[model samples]
Target: MTETPTATKEKPAHRSGLAAATREFVLIVVGALIVSSILRAFVGQMFIIPSESMQNTLLVGDRVVVEKLTDVERGDVVVFEDPGGWLGQEESGQKRGSVGRFFEVVGLLPDSSHGHLIKRLIGMPGDKVACCDAKGRLMVNGKPLDETSYLYPGDAPSAMDFQVTVPAGHVFVMGDHRSESGDSRVHLSDTGPNGGSPGDAAFVPLDKVTGRAILVVWPANRFDKLEIPDTFKDVPAAAAPPPDKPSISLTPPPK
Candidate 1:
């Protein structure tokens, strides 16, 4: 009997070791979650392309990294919250439950099903944006935008003609696949149910922009850094129009 006891004497020690290992693993997982949450809340986040709106530049299903702190400039691809129901529905039509949405908020999952939208920032505040010059190019503050570098093949700059002055503190955005995309041009006439102004419904406020999309990260083969097109560099600064001179109305001399 004494000899048999020797074989089982170390069982408690083995059990203790296993328990310690499990505890360590749980701690590691919790730590990782905390780090991920912090990074996503304040630094950057991953978003998936949900439509062909930005096609040829970003395909559907492509995951992109959006930098939260970067300066958004003209021609930068940006992700923004839907302003005043601007985005009616998602192309994929995917829905997420509350649990899944929680994970997305914590950076544990990609928010592909959310109502956010991605588009190229075409006009900055106070810029005049118009469609179709003589050569069928978009005009930004009197400069013709050469969009061939990123526009979908054989796609026109815009099929629908429009002209708008981007109001202060707002931006005008458009998609590369102009014909298929319902971007700023599509919302130009949306006055909302409350009879809000046109620009109020169409323009995206600066505060609504989440971040600038800077990289394509999904599918491995499609990985690439997004860069501003050379055409944006050639765009001239928007010149300020002269202030209207105060009209001097001549009052009838005591008629």
Candidate 2:
């Protein structure tokens, strides 16, 4: 007698093309967002320019990438939080709907330049910074800074007089549009006894500096890398403080 034919099990059904495609799309989107978020949170972030403070170099609508990977240097453009009451008014007037806000949050759009200030790092801790010498230029650590390369046309180094020495762990910053920027100069009790003042309002603590503006990525025509001007690189370190004189009275001063 012939043996009974063996029974065969049916293969499992394959997933529909549309269903598979949708699942893959969702996964790709999720993965892309994760990478973007990581890059934005630690490597770099994007910010929109809100004012003319950094004009000529940065436009009002320009988008810039601020990198957190390096130490800030004098002459580097930095984005920092409002040191106390620096931002008098909301610089950003962006009115976004739910979708816009969502996109910004997920790193798909640039952040509003709100609650932040961007300026050129001019004076490091202990560096004596002053404005308007005989020829009318900024003096940093006794060296005149020739700012013609980026200073807005027809503007003076500073219309106001200020002399300050950046205090320890702080920096003095100013906008390229000196006339329009309400920078360290605006908060000076006098510009310390005001470097005691980024000791006061104008001097920004290193902690407040979120990142250095590394590149302009928007307004295709305006894209460029931000570099430390040669003038800043050539600035000499602050002179050493003079030693105190010995006491003339009977007892020596306590150490």
Candidate 3:
């Protein structure tokens, strides 16, 4: 009634195959989890707007989807690092606990120097930006911008005046809600030496740009894809040579 030697040898081979299959299954599950974590960390991050800096365009409590593409152009809404001078000097967020903040500085968690700021790119590197011409409109490279589409009704383009040439590899940004926004113009007179003189404003480094805000993905009613504005439609590319005509300079910032 005992089995032959051939049958007994085959039993061990069957068990070996089963063990190999089980090992493969476990590895697949682990690999999937790791990939997902990385994607959440860098590819696309969800954020809630905590302030009214971009009201009408983006409201408080609205969640947005930010992509990691860095080739953003003018009139595009973008999220960037707060530059510490703007955000608190120390990390004080839920994600950046005392221990986590320490690690973030040493490359443990994400860099805490990175902060969340959303605004529109008005002027790119090496471009001349001025505000309030004869008709009270913002101008770039002698071309007036019609911000009627995005500018909040009843609000002027900007109450505080600014005129500056964005540094090489930097950008000039502003908020849709001009009156409430404390953007590049707000820091023109910062105590720092690099804050720039009365008429000029500090520039935002290109490396600080995190990503472009491509959509308002939360709150079904507010969901929509963001598009580049026509205001920059007639405006020439950054590489184009400056026009021969003179571009007016708005009132300089306070001394």
Off by over 4 Å in 2: 1-17, 93-98, 190-199, 240-255
Give lDDT per model, in order.
0.79, 0.78, 0.69
lDDT by residue (1-255, candidate 2, tens digit) is: 899999997654564667788999999999998988888778888999988898888989999999988899999999998777677564643646789866766788887866788999998777777876777788887788999998988888888776766777788899999888888877775233323312266677889898999899888988899888888879998785421211011221122
Provide the clash count, candidate 1: 0
Ranking by lDDT: 1, 2, 3
Query: Model 3 — which ten-residue stretch has the worst lDDT?
Result: 241-250
lDDT of 1 by residue, 1-255 (tens): 355554545568879999999999999988988998898877889998888899999998899999898779999999998777666565543668899877887898887747788999998877777776777788887888889899999899988777777777778899998877888888776764456654456778889899899999888999999988888887777676411211111121111
lDDT of 3 by residue, 1-255 (tens): 997776444557779999999999999877765665565457755666656677788887667777774588889988787643665322222355888665443333443323667789998875778776778888876778999888877889878676766666677788888887778777665533354344233556778787788888778899988788898887765555433221224464223
State every prediction's TM-score relative to the real structure. Answer: 0.84, 0.81, 0.71
Compute the lDDT for candidate 1: 0.79
TM-score for model 2? 0.81
Considering every candidate listed, which one attains the maximal lDDT? 1
Task: Give the better candidate number (2 or 3) by TM-score.
Answer: 2
Q: Can you list the residue pairs that collide in candidate 2? A: 192-195, 194-197, 196-199, 197-200, 198-203
For model 2 the local lDDT of residue 229 reads: 84
